[model samples]
Target: MAAANYFESKCFLFFLLASLVVDGIVAAAAVPKQQRLDRISSLPGQPPVAFSQFSGYVTVDETHGRALFYWLIEATSVAEKKPLVLWLNGGPGCSSVAYGASEEIGPFRINKTGSSLYLNKYSWNTEANILFLESPSGVGFSYTNTSSDLKDSGDNRTAQDALIFLIRWMSRFPAYKHREFYIAGESYAGHYVPQLAKKIHYYNKAHSNPIINLRGFMVGNAVTDNYYDSIGTVTYWWSHSMISDKTYKSIMKDCNFTEEKSSARCDDAVSYAINHEFGDIDQYSIYTPSCLALTNGSRQHMRVKNALLHRRVSGYDPCTENYAERYYNRPDVQKAMHANTTGIPYKWTACSDVLIKNWKDSENSMLPIYKELIAAGQRIWVFSGDTDSVVPVTATRFSLGHLNLHIKTPWYPWYSGNQVGGWTEVYEGLTFATVRGAGHEVPLYQPRRAFIIFRSFLKGEKLPKSKRISLQLSFN
Candidate 1:
């Protein structure tokens, strides 16, 4: 969770997964590469399950005096030859292992009581090697002694450092040089994923290294444009009947977006939405059902009557909560031992300002990177969960509109059952998907759907078509 920029009314805006964790200082005068190896070696292994693990530190930005701590889990089935997926969680200062691993798609799931790790039936590790990184220097267990190094945490530097880390990481594990690499993340990663991809693309071109084979990228409920994200939220609120039509119109007139202004308009609009109860606004309640419930045009699913009662007798569905305690907040883990103990920082809170500073000044954008990838014959995907008012699907759609890619496969329903929960669109070499009943954390909320989407991404396959469907322009 990136910091809450209450000034912009930007609540817990995360760039997904990138931050430097400050853990005071380690006792070792010099970072012991061997000790680093031993610490990581202590991780439990499932070799019979075909998983190989690798860990090491990489200096991502020498000028800024920054480095990264990361771990790689190789899928046993295709250890020698498989694509690599880099997963990041958006906290600005949150640990990728904490969210991406424990909460989302790593091999293990966290126990909800925040106590232990459990085997995950839907782990993404089943598909390919997954790399989880703790970036910058002050997030999670990653540490730094130089307080000066903590200053000026910006996006460009983060991207540069991430690129540096990847190059160095790949060198350590040489076999992955020729492998296909794709970046995926959610929330604030709206900035991290694209910006990092842009830098990687630039370096790949400058160095002419075929070894740095860049595939495409993925983002969930990402924040691309501040204006649309905020405005779209108001629109979401009004459409969901959360706000009055009069207030929605007033908000539209009051909120003004300008390139000259940083993100003040977005803040103002959000305040307006909250103050007015979303009157005619497009924003959805962070705690309520999504606009999908209100706008599926009678095609939506009605909950089964007495399903809850039947669940008591039949053991319906399983919902486990604390899969993260295994890696984060662990008493024995070195990272946990060095964790920040100043305040009661949630290992999994929705927001944090300490992390937000890492990217408040980032000027990097992914559209140019997207353009280059497209021209280079690489496939790309940009998706979001429709119900996330934070980084709603509307903003993502508007951002993609800038690409001007003619919708070759237009919007259509991609279903798991009789349900039409989400939508998809396929353009030349690009596939966009929206998971139904999903929130900012798409994979966690809609695991089965997320698996299908990612599986298709790994194969470079397009989503199957549905009957003629058009993108909905408005809610009502």
Candidate 2:
């Protein structure tokens, strides 16, 4: 009789376990497809495409009603097998939608007219599932009900909010929850990528079933160390004949680039170098012409200067920012993307002027975070566009010097096709490379080369070296 009772108990436990498993499956299946918000349909003016595109908001702060806008473009082919890449643009306030997606490496480029779109032959989406996010509360279509969320934005808060967004985003798109993921960005995203990666690493350690499969991160012409970046900028300007020797000397002698507040003498020197010396040229891409020519009339000078400073680099159009601004603000475009759902008070912009002015916190150095992440066995790649003076390759090189990492691969030229593309070096924990003539926006200046390097990054392979034509070997 006791044996019979034990068998019955085993059967009951087995049935309960099966029932729970069945319930879990049912619950997962019950998630409504409509709730997935897989885009109300395709966007108009978009070039014919095979991959799916989805755009919507993911609420990060319920109390403040803060939500982030995202545009996810699936890979052109075999998207289910490709890794997912989250691309952020750092102004601490820039719209990834406007810059990263529409103007740089996204699947489509806004036409010069701003009302049409063109296929980007070298879109990063061809290599991976690309996700562009407009972060914080005030940038692009992302917003918050509580006005303070805009003014209170900082590096830490932004990173935390982005982390929350990623978690919730994964919940909505469960297919990508366990997929390999990478975070990449440029300029100030040097802060955003590392901080968010650190948060994910911490969360993975604390949780039993980690959803985010964060594999690595990359930053381009990033502002990693402010002091190094400042010094490098001044030195680069001087070396490149963009500033007077006297100005350079004065800046070096009086400026403590590491300080939060610059000395008056330093400020004066920098102003002379940038304003008087560089003049009306685009500071971001010193080699590129300004979107609008500097007018001789003093009345138009300030406006021209602002336009130069704010313009995005596009090989095809210098006025890409103007085009993007018009494209995003259109009611039809917003409706198609399912953006501005609550009728936010302000129009969408490429960069948030208010957030930039009110930015509360910025770290001088992200090297320590890089060190921690590297030691934790995360892949790290730092690439620079050789021609970008704003955050020059010199700045990146100098900053990496602070890590004192052991050299794994000595610096060598990498090739794209039969021509030299850039120089690359591998350290014990990090890799550094330069896109030969590319500017602040690498993909904008050299999309094909950028795609090649990007593919190498994802594959954990060294960039290709020049091959003999007789061999008929191609890197791609």
RMSD of 1: 17.2
Q: What TM-score goes with each of the models?
A: 0.74, 0.89
Candidate 1 lDDT over residue span 1-476, tens digit each: 23445633442233221121222234342444543442343343222344766554566655544557676777757667778988876546556766677667777665445554566676777778898877656555454455555556666767777787787777666668879898888766767787887788778778855567877788777766655555565666677666677767866775564343435554455455555563332222144333322232311110110010000000001222223433355545433333333332344322223554433464434566677778877767777776656556776777677778877877787754345647898987678898877766677667766776787788776653432221121100
What's the lDDT for candidate 2? 0.82
Candidate 2 per-residue lDDT over residues 1-476, each given as its tens digit: 99999999999999999999999889868764633565546676877788988888888989989999998999999999999999999876888998899878998888767778889888999889999999887999999999988887988989999999999888878888889999999988888999999999999999999999999999998988877777777778889899888888998998886677777787677777766888766666777776662233311111110112333343446678777887888899889899999999988878887787678888778999999999999999999998877788898898899999999999988887667889999999899999988888888888877887788889898777664521232333
Separate clash counts for every candidate: 50, 0
Q: Which ten residues in a row have the lowest lDDT in candidate 1?
A: 306-315
Q: What C-alpha lDDT do the candidate models reach, one value each?
A: 0.59, 0.82
